[model samples]
Each structure stands twice: as structure tokens, then as C-alpha cells.
Target: MNSRFDPSPAAVPPRGQLLLVSICLALYLLFCLQQIVLPFRFFGMTLSLGSVTMLGCMLAISAGSLVRHGVPSELVRPLLAILMCIAALSASVLASNHIGLACAFAVRYATSLLALWAMLSLAAACPRWPRAATLAALIAVWFNLALAGAVWFQWPGALRVALAFHPEETFKYLPRISGMYEHPALLATSAAMVLLLVLRLQQRGEVGRISLALALVGAVLALALTQVRNTLLPVGVLMAWWAWPRSCTSNRQRHIARVALGGIAVLAVFVLWLRYPDMTSAAQENMMTAFTLGRTYLWSGALDAWREHPWFGLGAGVFQFMVPDYTGGRFHRGELHAHNLLLAALSETGLFGLLAGLALIFALWRPLLRIAAERQWAIAWLILVLGLSTFDFYFPFFPFSMHAALAVASLHAGHCAPSQADGVSRSTT
Candidate 1:
């Protein structure tokens, strides 16, 4: 196959394809900038320019794909259907408690679904566009890493501008960095996803290998600087998974080696723990304190809500309203994401929502398993990120979830065209 850059004129992507590329790029920009383009009120509903842009592009691409392709793949329809069901179910369940919050949750969920469908359509409709999307992701990673480096080192010019952009939240975890995201974790999530994407692109021969290798290193460093423990899990898993095959012989051998490596890592930590017992104790205590953050009480409350609304959840986005009652108003100050996707789903949408969430996860991961192991790493990366969501939530947010779904969709697209020789294919089995 011709390189992504050397496509012939006829191979040039259509305007709608270009729009897809633009949407991917704009999402990254919006996530990093942390500033909504505009804000307004309509019939007592608040809206933003960023939201309008996202929705408009998604609608345009979805409509375009429908006309051009006569409905998206069977896979896309089910995924969208599942998402819509979850959102609608949640909104309907919670409408009575607070219509405004329910509407907000519904809107967020809808945007997420739109983004998913848009990315999937873009990838499926224009084979050329994934390369561009991957490239855009790489560019965003590079820019963010630079900005994060500046913030990490306290560069005066960067700090001044970054602070001016979102003083209250950006770099709030100072000495740590957010890199234009509202928090360090969000930045880490974005970088980690992009790193996996670059790696996938490199494997596919879509991007230069050396440049992406460097970008991967840069992304890893930036992720570390963010100091987000949960996000680190996925990235760490990705690195180890990538490195595992390089050092081992056969499948069985690799499995044994991975276990051995994990054992060694655990033992090393144990030794360090013994060597610095007091420090270890203090660190453990602090971690536990931070991790709890009234999560126990909150989780218990969620369980109570789940029991009461056994079939459906208390309604999507109702957890925030119920938290006050659960914790006696102790932990109601911060965001109400539940810090765990499962718990949030259970509390917000009950058993049905949880099942739908699981199905969605299955849809994302199942296809990758049928492909080669090296290709499987992309989905592995996603699985780890989703696993991390069990400890901390980000995927529910539109940009984060959209990027994730895109990665999954790209993998599925790649799987469907396994004959195409790309960078990873040559390098892998």
C-alpha cells in the first residue's frame, strides 16, 4: 500500500473526510485548552460554543455517512444503540428528582454517543482518515508535552499564559502539571491514549517509526509528571505488554516470563517497603486517606440507591443529589463522578445500565482478540485505561470516551483489513 503521505489525487480524501479529521483535531484542542469557545443561554438551558461545534460536526458526519454509505456497519449501530439506551434510561429514571441535572447528564451522554458514532463513521467511511486522525493525535501529544514540560519546570512565559487561561484549575496540582487540562489525570489520560495511538500508527507504517518512538518516550514522561496513580496503571501495562514479547520466546514462555517479571516487581517493592518501613507506612497511610476521600460512605450510599432503584438507577446524574443524604453532606463538595465507572453506572442507571456498560466494553475489546497479539496491544491499552477507570473515572467525559472509542474503532477497522501492510504488521508477526 502507498504511504499515507504519498496518496494519489483520486485517493485524496473527500471534504467530509477532511471534516472528520478536523473534528478529531478540534477535540484534542478543546480538551487541552480548557476554555469553552463561547457560552450562552437558550430557553433557560445553558450551552457553549464548544458543545455546538462538537454536536454540529458529529451530526454532519453522521448524516453524510448515512447518505454516502447507507447506514454504518452493523457494529456501529449496536454500540450507538447501547449508548442511547443507557443515556435515555438514566435520564428518564432521574427526571423527577431534578430535570435540569438529568438533562445535563443526558446531553453529556448524547454528546459522547455522537462522538463515538462520528469517529466510527469517519474511520469506516474514509480509510485514509485514520492515518490523519492518528497524526492529529500525535501533534496534540507533542504540543501538550511541550506545554506540560514548560509548566513542570515553571517556565515564566508558559506559566503566565497557562495560568491566565484557567488560573483556578490548570496546574492546581502544582509541582505537578495538567498541561492545559483541568487536572493532571485528564492530561495523563489524553497523553496515554495518544501514546497508544502513535504506537499503533507506527506499527501500521502510517507514521515514521523514529519520530513516534521519541513521542512515546515524551508522552510517558509527561504522564509520569502528572503524578496520577490510576492513569499510570494503563501506561505501565502498555509498556510492559509492549516489552514482554521482545524479551521472550514462545507464548507459554512469554506468559511465564510475564508472571516472573510481575513477581520480581512485587518483590522489589516489598524489599523497598522493608528497607524504608516508616516511609512505607506513612505513604500507605496517606494513600489510604486520599483514596478513601469518603468513598466508603459514598459507595455505601450508592448501594442504598441501587437497592431502592433495583431495576433502573436513581436516574443518570442523580448521584450528586443523593450524595448529600448519603454522607450527611460531608463529601458533596467535589465532582460527583463516583471515581468508579461501575459504581457510577449502578447508582445512576442500575443493573441495566451496568450491563450496557459491560456490553460496550465487550464491543471495544472483543474484536481485538481475534487479531494478532501485537495488534492486540492497542485494545490492551484501552482495557487497562478502562480498568484504571475502576479506580478513577475519565472515560465518561466526552473527549476522553470519544478518543477511547476511536481507538477501539480504529482497531476494528484495522482488523477488517488485515492484509494491508503497515509498520506494526511488518514489525509484528
Candidate 2:
């Protein structure tokens, strides 16, 4: 019920080309797993395998796509803005208190921003979007293996995540979750997005019921492990979408099913509320705590950083660097992120970066709305993503939305003809 229901991008190059896609996927998975499973820490610096893999994939994929088709100007603007923002952040760090540490993170930030855009430009106009989408789903499942393993390990990942986070009092406790993501918020957001894909598979009545069931159970467990309250909003959106009553009278109703998922959700919330009265406040403080407090604190910190360097506050990777200064000389404090995607640019790269991001988001809206109006299964997919982004960074969330962009491109390119996903011409031969 949520995403733009466009299947225009559901193309496959050819069975022969799947091999190329698979090799790329294998490399990406290795990076995600290495970052989490083996988390490297040395010389008081962390060089995560995940970020490396992420950046590497972005670069490789962007190159592959550009080689296939020249880079479009529409894509280049935002990408350059982000890069410039990173550069500014790096420069600001040199002026900061710790040149060494800021430099380290600056490198990391530079890598992430580049990798993100590369993937975006590369996939934005590719063909056979569904084939690419299918590949993405598999990768998501691979990443989610961590959540499954944690569930099997009998570890209360949910609790571990809560305790790990500052401004303490989170009490979410779910055992054996998280395939590899170290942070609960990251885990929750990713799980939510993957779950939407599984739901898409399940809706298709294709070869996805059993697999989707497994993915859903694992995703829920992982979300619990994250103990992230933000999961509620995205999950809530899904529930509402599911609950919207089916207008049996409307011709479009048969095209989609609006189950009373929200009612079920309300019932569940009521049950949880009932438990609160019988238990200590600590028993469920995770749910009791204000959900947006941490995000608010980080955003507030970002604002302070902006004020100091109104032009380009801090540096791209300088959020943490700027925190102490913003705190009025307090040392060793909590970290900060723009939290909201657009604001991240505003605070980190000043108005320049922020405008670029907004332009991209605006660019996406037209196509997104067109797809949404189509009311296809994919539309449901996008809605869930929308919910997921509220809590986590989804803007240029890459792998998650790459296929979506391709689908939009396919629609406009006639890739999704009434006849085929490949936009091929029929041959009697």
C-alpha cells in the first residue's frame, strides 16, 4: 500500500549476465560480514570491513554503470555536493582540537559518501530492474544472516543493544538476534527494509512464501535485538497500510488487499501496556523512554556545530569532532549525526550540501509519486521504506533504493512494455 507500484524497472539483462551480478554480490556480502563478524580495531582506530565493502561496491557499481552509459548531469550535482561537504568537513577538522582522530573519520566519511553516489548513478538508469531487485533481496538476506545467528546463539541482542546505547534505560530484550550489524539502530532499519522485500515476494504468490516467512521471523527478532524504538514508527506504518479496509466495491480493491493489520497492532500495543502496570518502570523503560530523545540530542548538537561554522559547520566526518566545541568545552561526550538526511548536509556541509541533497530528494519525489499512484506491490515496498527512513538514514541509502531508481528509469525508458521485463522485441526466429 505504500511504495510506488511501478514494475517498469523489473528487467533482466539475460540469464548469462546473472553471473556478473552474482560475483559482485559475493564481494559485497564479504564486506558486510567482515565488518560485523570480525570488526577490526587497531591502533585506536576502527577500519570496518562493512564500510570498506560498501564503498568498494559503490565505486565498482558506479563505474560499471557509467561505462554502460555516460554519467547524467542530474545525478552528478548531488554527488559532487556530498563530496564537497566531506572535503569541507575534513578541512574544518584540521582547525579542530584533534587533527589525528578527525582525519581518520574524515577518510571514512569520504569513502561512504562517494560509494553511496557511485551506486546511485550506476543503477539509476539500468534495465531489467526486477532482476536487479531480486539480486538485492538475496544480498539483504545474506546481511540478515547475522540476525539469524544471534537468534540461534540465545543472546539477548535486544538488551545488549539497549545497554550499549547511551541516555540509558532501554530494556528491550530479545534473544539470539543480529546476523552481523553491531549497532541496534542500524540493525533495525535494515531489517525493516528487508522485511518489506520479503512481503513483496509473499504478495506475489511466487516462490517466496516459505523464504519470506523465515525472513520475516528473523527480521522481527533482529528488530527486537536492536531494541530501537524507532522501529515502531516504520512497523506502525506497515501495520496501518495493512489495516486500511478493503473496499470490496472499488475495482482497485481486488488488485490489492488491505488487511486489518493496524487493529492487530493496536491489540498488541494494548497488551504491552497492560504488562506495564504489573511490572516495574525499569521492566519496560525501553518502550517507556521517549523515542526521539536521542535523535533530538544529536540534531541539537548538529545545530550548535552549524552556528559555530555557519558556512560549513565542522566537517563532513566532523560531527563527533564538533560535539565537544558545541558542548561548550565538555570532553568525551555522546556522538552526533544529522539524524535527518537533509539536515546532515546542512550541518556538515552547510547550505551548499543541504541544497544539493534536497534537490536529489525533490528529483526522486516526482518519479516516486508516479509509482505510488500506480498502486502496485512495489508501491507497498516504498511506503515501508518511507517509514524506515524516519528512524534511520535512507536518503541515498543505496542498495535499498538502487533498484527503485532503476525501476523508475525503466518505466520512463519503455523497459516495461506490456510484453516483457527486458523491453525486448519479439523474434519469430
Candidate 3:
């Protein structure tokens, strides 16, 4: 396999390929900054310029792939899985009480799949695509961190600019800084993912020691400012896992220690839950309630909705609307989602949709495993992203889902050849 950091002349991408990769990377950076960019409503869905541009780029890439070479054999399973997921979501839409909302969600899901396909195709076309993407992600994350700092320090005109680009009205009421994103949790998760990528690149000798140190410090600052405990918890765990010295202990000992620690953590959490009332002075101020932001109530409501429609679900995007009905208006207005990916999936698509989702993950198992072997930190980044989704919506959201797809495609591209690898007998580009 040709490594992006390979010093051989043949490993270097050609000038044209470099230019193309740079352009795509630039567009991706814009996509990362979508929240701050001006947006327009299209059929009741808000569309950012960055998203439209990226979509156009993806369409162009897809078209070029069709004309140059047919779909790669390696992608057959993944494409089928995506189609199955879309079909399941469409079925849920049919069962939804709010047809328009469900349809919109279904369309977004389709778009996300298209973006994934385009990324994989691009990776096949450009061997250096993954390296370029890593650099772009790092730069974009640092830029957002800088913006967050500006907002924090009350820089001139920063607040005004942030307000103008802010999508949610409730943002003005909150003290947390979201930077260019719709929510602080989103920014925090994105930062964590990028930080992991940076660490991986450094481990592979693609980044310098100074760069790695700077990234670590910047990531810590950003996480502190975001104050998102969900993201913070996973990040803390990952950092500790990575920082632990491995030379002193055998692999078996390490594994045993990790297992023991995990058991202890679970037991502690159970005890806390059991004695939460006695531990807190008031119900509203309890650690569980504060940590979850009262999401336990919302989760219960979602479970109620799921119980009512255990099979097909309420539909692709009906959960938010039905929140008031299920929660008795306790979580009405600006709540937007179930705030948890699995709960949202269960409440909106039910068992059928959940099964389709699982199938999609299973289909990508090979690529994910390949990534784990070649770039372990990428898998860690993926895990962190999923962990964040447990506390907030990431999969159902636009750009965030696209971001994950890009990472997977880039990593898969790095490990496989454009042709002859993974059963591809012909050029996929």
C-alpha cells in the first residue's frame, strides 16, 4: 500500500491530483463551517451554501465516476446497505403522522448516503485524499476554536457576527459558546474527532511533534469552553487510554485492568442512580438531572412513544413534533429532537428502521475493521463520535453525518488500491 507519508517520488500525487484534492479539501472546510455561513430555506429545510457546494461537488464526482468507470465492486455491499436503510426510513415516513417532516428527513438521509458514495469515489480517484482531509479537518477545528475564543473574550464585533449566523433562537439565552455550530456539543464533538485525527497523523509521522502538542492544548481549551459533559467524558477516557504507558505492563494485564475499571465504573453509576435522591438537596439539582439536562424525562417520553408504535415507529421525523404530546408539553419548543440517536431512531423508525441501521453497520464492518488496523485512532475517533450521539443528535443531523462519512471513506481509501484490491478487478475512479 502507498502511504501518504511515503518519501518515494512515486508516492507523491501529481500536480493535477494535488489541485483537485486541494479544491475538495477547501469545500470540505466550508462544510465544516456551515453553521456560520449564510443559509437559505429550500422546501422548508434550511440549506447552507457550504452544503450546496459540497453537494454539487459530490454530484460531479458521482457523474465522473459513472462516465469513467462503473461502481466499484468493493462498494456493492455498502451501497446496498445504504439503499436498504433508505427504504426502511421511507417506510417509516409512510407511517408518520407528519408526512412533510418525515419526507424532509428521508431526503436528508438520502443526501447523506450520496455524500458517502461521493467521498468513496473521490478517495478512489485521489490516493492523497485522506492526508488532505486530515489537514483540512485540523485547520477547520483550530479555526473554530479560535472563533470560540474570540466569542469568549468579547472580541469586537464577534458577538454580532456569531448572532447573525446563529440558527437557534435559544442560543441567545444560553451562556455557552457554540462558535460556528448550532450547539456547543456539536463543536465539542467535532473538536474531539479532529484532535484524534491529529493524534493519528502524528503517530504515523505525518505531523510534527510541535503540531501535536499545540493540537492537544487547543483541544483541551475548546473542550473546557464548550462544557459539554457527554463529549468531555469520552474525550477524557480516550486521552487516558492513549496516555497510559504500555511498555511497563503486559497486554493481558492491561486488558484485565481495563475490565476491572469498567466494572467499577458501572457499579458506581448504578449506586449513584439508586441513591440520587438522597445525594441531592433538590430533584432539579440532582447530578443525573443536571448531567442529562433533564433528558431523562424526554427519554421516558420517547420510550412511551416507542411503546405505542413498536414496529414501524412514529415515522422518520415525527418524534420532535410528538414530544409535546408524549411529554405533556414539558419539552415543547426548540427541543428539535429526542436528543439521543438511538432513542430518536426507535421513536421515529422503530424496530424496522433500527434493524436497517444495524445492517448498514454490518455491511461496513470490513471497511471499519480495515480502518482499525491501519489507523487505530480513526476508530477511536468514530467511537467518540458515537458516544457523543448518545447525548445528542449526530447521525440524523446534516453536516455532522457527512463529516463521519468523509472520515470513513478517507480511511477506507487509504488502505485499499483504486483497482485490484478488495475484489476490484477494474479501476474504480
Candidate 4:
């Protein structure tokens, strides 16, 4: 019936507010370019333009938030401080390389995590901007889908080559499109994230039913073209969970049943693995196989690194250096990350970082549950975040992670009152 687009930001905000909205929108557009790697010298250090813009926005928003709204009552600041302290400690004490490398790693770690918190705080400051955030996320989705559609229909190689980190490998597969990201899996993940944002907007009545249906169709088509299975499993689960009948069931019972269902699914997979060992071989050959594909070596090396430094683990972004020692140069070669979020946390920052991460998740959990209880479609976005991170490491990829953070910020502030999302009793400004 009616379009769900909110024009309040344009209609109500004063000149300064309008400027802030325009700046945010422009930054999101740059971030959505996903393929572009415009690097320049910034204070003697090389950095991507997109990353610098995002970081600057985060710092500015956080500073303005502190000034207008006072400090957030949420655990964002203290958790951030703890993470930085641990990163500094790990860099100095447990790093396996030169001091400079350790310092660089720590800086990267802080910047990445801080970007996430910055989005959260920005949402807290501007509670009415979830519609804007959703629009930005949708733009990213459309950009990715258009590029992927072109690649699937035998588009010229020159166009595809521009979007990939490795131009030589861009055309290795006939119809498998990588969209604007480095890998097909990354494109799939980013697209799935965009779909989640769309679904969230629909839940808040910010998207029409017909538009939602068409968006879902387009997103799934793009995901299939990417040929990435990691993105499929979670999206499938989200659909099933969203469509699951909830009548006559108590909340506690539903929670228990969900846990049981998860366990059953895991066991069923294990049984299938034992029954058909040949599937393992097939899995190794295909990169889409979730468990196989020589990831054990990666996981093993990660565990070994964790055992070496149990508390803080190896240092931030040091998984590559330590994993090689355990992989014997077999599977770890040229692999920059642990490929799994929890493993990356364990291997890089160890238990301390993992705990901090959990704390951060817990901070977001309350609002998430509140929203999910009211709107089942809302859970999919959070599931998309966990699902991608579980199967692949997107935390260090600033473009993807920044978009994810935007979705989370929108969700965190979407259903709750302004005071509730900020975890404050009253608005200060």
C-alpha cells in the first residue's frame, strides 16, 4: 500500500542535522564501492580512502555523541578500553614478530573494533536514522546485485577484473561471479547482509510487501551466482526460523526446542559424514564445503597458537605468522586469516579478547531479543552476522564489517525507545 520510506530526517532536521545526514550517506556510498581500493598516504602511513572516511566518521560521531548525549551508559566504552589495553599488552608481550609489526597489528585491531562501536553510538545519538541506515544497506545490495547479474550473463572480462583483488584469477570460473568484493564468498556474504537489512526494514514497515518480495528474489539470485555455500546455510535457517509457527508455545519452551534442534542438526550431519566418507573427498575438492577443505590445519594451528599463549594468545593479526609453524606450509600459505571468527579471536587475542567479544555481543543481545520477540524477521539479520563470521572472517574486512555494524546499529535502535537503545534512563541532550 504505502511506501515505508521515512522523510522525517529531511523534513524535520535543521541545516546542521541535514549536513550530518548527507555526510553519513556519502560515506556509506563510498563504503559500498566494495571493489575500489583507492589508497593514499595519510601521515606517512598508507590507508584506503574508504577506511579513512569510515574511521573519521566514527571518531566524529562518537565525539559528538559524547558532547550532546553525554557518555553512553552501554558497555561500549569500557569494553573498547579493555580491548585496546589487551591489544597493547599482547603486542608488547606476546607478539611473534618485530615491535613495529605488533604495533601495527594492535592499531588495526583497535580501529576495526572501534568502528563497530562507533556505529552503535551513532545510532544511539540519532535514534531516528534507522531508515537512513536501511536505505544505505539497500544501496549496497543493489550495487552488488547489478554487478553480479552482469558477470553471470557473460559480461566482458575487463569489467569483472576491475572488481577483484587478483585480476588474473577473476575469470577462472565461467559463471561464478565475485561481484565487487575480493572473493565470491565475500560477495555472497555482503549480499546476504543486505538482504537481512531489507528484511529488517520490512519488519519496521519501512519497506513495502511487493518491494520486499522482489528484493528477496534478487538477493537469492545474486547469492546463487556467487556459488558460496556459507552464506546459504544461515539464510536458509533464517527463513525457516522466520516462518516457523509459534502458536501455543511458551518462550522458555521455544528456547529449549531451538537448542535441541541445533544439537540434532549437528548430530545428523556427523552421522551423514560417517555413513559417506567419500563426501569428505568431494568436500575437499570444492571450496564451498563448510567443514572440509583443509580447514582442520587452520584450526589446528589456531589451537596451537592459543595453547602457546593462553591468556592473550598470539597478538592481534598474528595468525598468519604462527599458523605457518603448525601447517607446515600446506594450507596456511597465502591465507591471511583464521577463516573463522572465534578461532581468529582465540588465536589473535586469546581468551581475553574472546571474553571481550562475548561481552560486546551480550551488550547487543538484549535489544536483539526484544526486537525478535516482537518481530521474527528481525532475528535474521543478527543470524546473518553470526553465520558469515562463523564460516568466514569478515571482521578485518572494513567494508563488509562496517556495513554489518550499520545493520546492527539500526536493529539495536529500531524497535526500542530512544532511551532504551542507549541504555540510559533519560536523554541528556
User: Among these predicted structures, which one has the highest TM-score?
Assistant: 3
Candidate 2 wrong stretches, greater than 4 Å: 1-25, 33-46, 72-110, 120-126, 129-176, 198-215, 238-260, 263-295, 321-339, 370-429
The true-versus-predicted C-alpha distance at residue 364 of model 2, in Å, is 2.9
The estimated TM-scores of all candidates read 0.76, 0.64, 0.79, 0.74
- Which tens-of-lDDT digit does each residue in 270-377 have in candidate 1? 434433544455456475544444466677777877777766777767677678776677665435656777777787777877777777766656665656654456
The C-alpha stretches of model 4 lying farther than 4 A from their native spots are 1-25, 32-45, 74-99, 149-174, 248-291, 370-382, 414-429
Instruction: TM-score for candidate 2, please give it.
Output: 0.64
lDDT of all predictions: 0.62, 0.49, 0.67, 0.61
Question: What lDDT is obtained when candidate 3 is compared to the true structure?
Answer: 0.67
Tell me the tens digit of each residue's lDDT in model 4 across 1-429. 234444553323456655655666677766544344555543344555555566677778766766655545553443455455455446444544445444556665566667766676667667667556655555556666676666667568747444543334555644567655666676667666766676556655566655466566656655556656566567657655644667734565456447644643554454344434545665666744435455666777888888887777667776776567877776544455777888888887778778777766666665466553534434556676787777677776665776777776776563433354353422432
Looking at candidate 2, the ten consecutive residues that score lowest on lDDT are 420-429
Q: How accurate is candidate 1 locally (lDDT)?
A: 0.62
Give the Cα error of residue 21 in candidate 3, in Å.
6.8
**Residue 121's lDDT in candidate 1:** 62
Error of 4 at 138 (Å): 1.5
Worst 10 residues of 3 by lDDT: 1-10
Better of 2 and 4 by lDDT: 4
For residue 65, give model 4's deviation from the true position in Å.
Answer: 1.7
Across 219-302, the per-residue lDDT of candidate 3 in tens digits comes to 665555665566656654654564455663356545644764464355446534644544564455766775576788788888
Which has the better TM-score: candidate 1, or candidate 3?
Answer: 3
Q: Per-residue error at 310 for model 4, in Å?
A: 1.6
